[model samples]
Target: MMVDVLYLTAAVCFIFALGGLSRAESAQRGNLCGIFGMAIACVAAYLSVNSADFWFILIAIVMGGGIGVFIARAVSMTALPQMVAGFHSLVGLAAVLISFSACFAPELFRISTPSGIKVLSLLEMGLGSTIGSVTFIGSLIAFLKLQGIYKGHSIPLPLNAFFASSICCLLFYFTVTESEEAFLLLTMISLLFGATLIMPVGGADMPVVVSMLNSYSGWATSGIGFTIGNHLLIITGALVGSSGAILSYIMCRGMNRSLWSVIFAPEQAKANDAVASGGTRAFKSGAPEDAAFILKNANSVIVVPGYGMATSKAQYALKELGDMLKKDGISVKYAIHPVAGRMPGHMNVLLAEADVRYDDVFELEEINRDFSSCDVAYVVGANDVVNPAAKNDPSCSIYGMPILEAEKAKIILFLKRSMGTGYAGIDNELFYASNTMVLLGDAKKTTEDIIKAMRE
Candidate 1:
């Protein structure tokens, strides 16, 4: 009865945690709720286990907890996506390990009958193992791409769909036959399938990939939960799976691409046909003083931040600039693209870290129309999100994707290091817009210079 009550409490906490995460204001509370819930669930699971398993579980907990703490403290915000991928891989691997252990000791797990293994138990084991294997390798590949270990380009494989389907069929057959050799074969093939699935995806779509892998990891965990007959794990896994799926869908819609296009037809969406034409366009350049002068006189300003801001660690400098502009009676607002930076909500996270006011920040849909009435649109290290090509040029890779409408502003000031293309390897036409001027330098240094000029 006590254990059941604890499980129910943990479930409630997990739901609250997810709710809190829906908005930035409640994100911290959501984290706290999740942590407390997990703690309660862990205690309940530990208490339910036999005395013989206690020491092993204790050692595992201490080691895992220590490693988690160290990684959380050491990892920088820029590497958060990679870290998340790595963690998902670990979760998948855990499911695989547990499935194997249960297979070796069916009596201990209560899955074995006097005659043979229960058919339902075998089915659960097979599904859990297959999903876990795929998730483990898929997440590893995602981590490699995010970490720059693997080139973030699609690797074409002939008959990829046929091979994947065949593998699934074989895995199902092996599960029914209860063949140990076939189980090993299924694991290897599933791993290969996972790698192939992610290898074709480009870097620009990594946010969606990360979220999709997270969903896989959750489903894998739920499969293991079924095998172990643990209701808490089931509930937690379902929550994670559903939430991850929703996030992935949201990201896909934000990029104006279907989920199918993101996964299977990524090459079509990311092909760069406009690269040759980009070099012929003319653009105006400006200095820090010019930017400062324009910004000082502006009646309203909208600051757009992207991955470059994160790379340069310039959120604090940006906040300072915004504060300065606000003091001059200029209405200042921040416009955040959903898929900005390397991950979803990446810009918001960085700005929040620098203590930027939440009320001052607005998403693309909210602040997009406001750009036309604004005096200046200040772009910091962002490229694709503010590019007019997304809306105007059908030949462009990012065509039809909704943009921040930075071009609609009376004046556009871009802070960049060079005229390089963005993650999709396509040039931004916004750089050549008649009303736009580029301030070429390090984003942090440039922002600091502008701030200093304002003070002077």
Candidate 2:
């Protein structure tokens, strides 16, 4: 009865934790709830086991807890997505290993005469192990790419007989594999397959990749539940897997991309030229004093942030500029697009770190309705989020993706360092908009200068 109660409480906490994570205001609380719930579940699981090997479990727990704490404290928010992917990969790998252990256990295998139930279990174990192994290696590669440990380059797929031959070989191997050794070999091959798959995708596609891997992790855990006959694990895993798939689909649509394209296309080959469109007309650059002059009298200003802000650690400067504008009685608001930075909620983490007020931040939905009302939109080192191509040009790669219509504002101030394209290798149409004024420099320095100008 106590065990049932403990499990029920764990389930409730997990649900609430996930619910809380849906909003920025409650994210921290959600994280705490998740941690606490996981703790309870772990304790209950260990207690339920009647075995006498408590010392081994204690040591494992202590080591795992120590490592987890170190990682959480050490990793920066910029690399959080990659870290999460790698962590999920580990979970999948663990599930696979556990399932494999159960399948080949000496005592169980010795007693069975290969009944239909045994065959089905073996098949499930093989499938789980293969998929989990692939997810593990794929996520590791993603982590390497995001960390700059690997050269972020695209790998082209063979289009002719080589591709056809490889697929045939993989199919033949899968069809013939019935033994545990063959399953292990297949797992290794799938791992290699996953590594090759994610290597061709650029950093810009990481959010979707992370979500997809999350789903794989969940499914792998579900397979573990099948192997162990654990209902709770199965339910939790299904919940995570389904939700992750939905999130991945949404992210793909948000980027005007297909999951297949992301999985298969060469990153460089799939580049979109956003600034080269017919509507892209570059205006004469304005002097800082002139730019300041125009912004000073603006009735409303919207600030847009991107990955560049995180890379340069410029949120503090941005907030300072916002304060100066607010002092001038200009209504200031921040516009955040979902895929603005390297990861999901990237800009929000940085802004929160800088102690920016939650109320001042507006989501894409809220800010879109107010774009026309905004006198000026100051784009800080963002390229794709403010690009008009996402909405206007069907021929463009990012067509159909939602964007901040900063072009509609009477004045658009873009702060960027160079003509070099963003992660998608696309020039920003927002940079060339008629009302747009480019301030080419380091984001933090330019923002600090603007704040100084405002003060003077």
User: Top model by lDDT, which number?
Assistant: 1
- Give every collision pair in model 1: none
lDDT value for model 2: 0.75
Q: Per-residue lDDT for 162-275 in model 1, tens only? A: 657867787678767877777677777878878888888887788899999989998998898888777877888898898789889988887888887777876764457354
lDDT against the true structure, per candidate, is 0.85, 0.75
Q: Model 2, 7-101: lDDT tens per residue?
A: 77777777888889788689789878878888888877777766688889889889988998899899987677767877988887887687667
The parts of candidate 2 lying over 4 Å away from their true place are: 1-5, 22-29, 106-117, 152-178, 266-283, 286-290
Candidate 1 ranges beyond 4 A from true positions: 23-26, 157-159, 273-278
